[model samples]
Target: MSETFAGKSALIIGAGQNIGRRIAQEWAARGARVAVADISREGAEETAQILRDAGTEAVGLHCNVLEDASVAATIDAAEKALGPLDIHMNNAGILSGGNPQDIPMAEWQRMFDVNLFGMVRANNVIMPRMLERGSGHIVNTGSFAGLYPFAASRVHYAASKAAVVSMSQNLALYLKQFGIRVSCLCPGPVMTSSPDAMKHFSENYVMRAPGSHLSVMTQQQTAKVLSDGMEAGRILIPTHDEAWETLVEVAADPDAFVEKKHREFLAGDPGRPGITQDVIDSIKA
Candidate 1:
């Protein structure tokens, strides 16, 4: 309806559901041709069909961020269907919870492979073409946990996302001269399709902080915030007030703030359980 992105083309990895799917829909509504890529072919097709039904040019492609070949193939397919990409959203990620010291090496590697390395894989394939075009926007989805060290159980996830934040910042600085913009969307808790994700977050992360009041947004609401930020050319898209405040506090006094939060977390959950198969399985869904 807005047509702000008329004639633009976007590739959204992880567009099968949740925030990624919403972003794809929003971009198509704004008149951009979209490629919805996901590990689930059915999900990707469903998203693309929804866009097509709305009179938008859209395609569905299978992509597993863990595989470099898959990433390259998906990019090729997207470009073939939607023309050259003007926007790239690396939104695929997995969640894992446990004490860093206790989580398995394999699980840690898996988390990094999907959450952090997956971003690298997509950027590696798409950034050069974007550079050659002399203009593009790359939005990497990060987390509030990445900004601060508050979520003790989500160590692997937070670490991977923190790397993403750092990578996006450096990318913005490196590519600004080339007419490319990079942004890190660091949002607080959002309503996800995972039935128990909200409950887990409420019990583990949100309520752990005594006076910290963080609002949870629906997927559509979060998508709108990110879309607005990307359109406005913002470098760091902080979607929640609490996350912003935490970022500010950390920036002002990194050591003191981090130490205080670490103490608070330990004080609140002294008996936090170790990484169990059920805990891992819960997040897998």
Candidate 2:
């Protein structure tokens, strides 16, 4: 909508901790009515308390994104408490560890349920109202993995995020005529929970330089960029400029990005991991 968040109503799903909480705090600072939803009642209450302390209109609700009923009820609660939804940020996500093959089916399913279906559920509830209102903004949380499929570390997570990209693009096109905007925030290594995130982004995914190719953006930097991108109605918000640059390069010549990454990986780039050679050599067993 507008660059100003003053008087805007924002609904943030999974807004209890980490990136989600930070976004809520930032949005509140900008004078938005904040509705915090989490699977944990206490967690949502905690975030709502923080927002209220800042004098922002705040509401807390427990929502399980995997459940249709819970998601529907959450939308009703948010509108009833905070007014019409002006912005919806789908940031609820879970990251899995190890190779996908080595992981269990149940583990993979749950991760997608939160990260993928969570977005689906949020849009399912919010998009209709947005369409009726003839104006709204949707920002879905994706990852760099959605762009680069070589992320063997978390295949299911990557797949879920890729689905997010597709959904976002489609929605952007379908809703553009009605003034509804859909954007995807594909961030690299954010400093969220150590376990909920892939290893703290090291140098492995970068080019052959200490501060080149790829780098992790601090959470605050990320929030600001995302906020700005949302205001600009950017369809794909890449926190690291390299991601969009590489995508463009790949579109022109696929081998350039691949060969560069292979050369960097072969050059002993740690790539967002803090592991030393000794730690790398040691087995978890």
Query: Which candidate has the highest TM-score of all?
Result: 1
Model 2: lDDT of residue 22:
74
Residue-level lDDT tens digits of model 2 in 1-285 = 245577899898888876677778888887789999998889899989988988878999999999999989998999999899999989888775564556677877887898988788878889989989999989898888887644655667778888888888988999999998888888875555535445322233222221234555566667778878877669999777777766787688777766766676677653553324433232221
Name the top lDDT candidate: 1
Whole-model alpha-carbon lDDT for candidate 1: 0.80
Local distance difference test scores for all models: 0.80, 0.77
Q: Tell me the alpha-carbon RMSD of every candidate.
A: 6.0, 6.3
Clashes of 2: 8
lDDT digits (tens) for residues 165-193 of candidate 1 = 99999999999999999989987766566
Clashes of each: 0, 8
**Where is the poorest 10-residue window by lDDT in model 2?**
202-211
lDDT of 2: 0.77
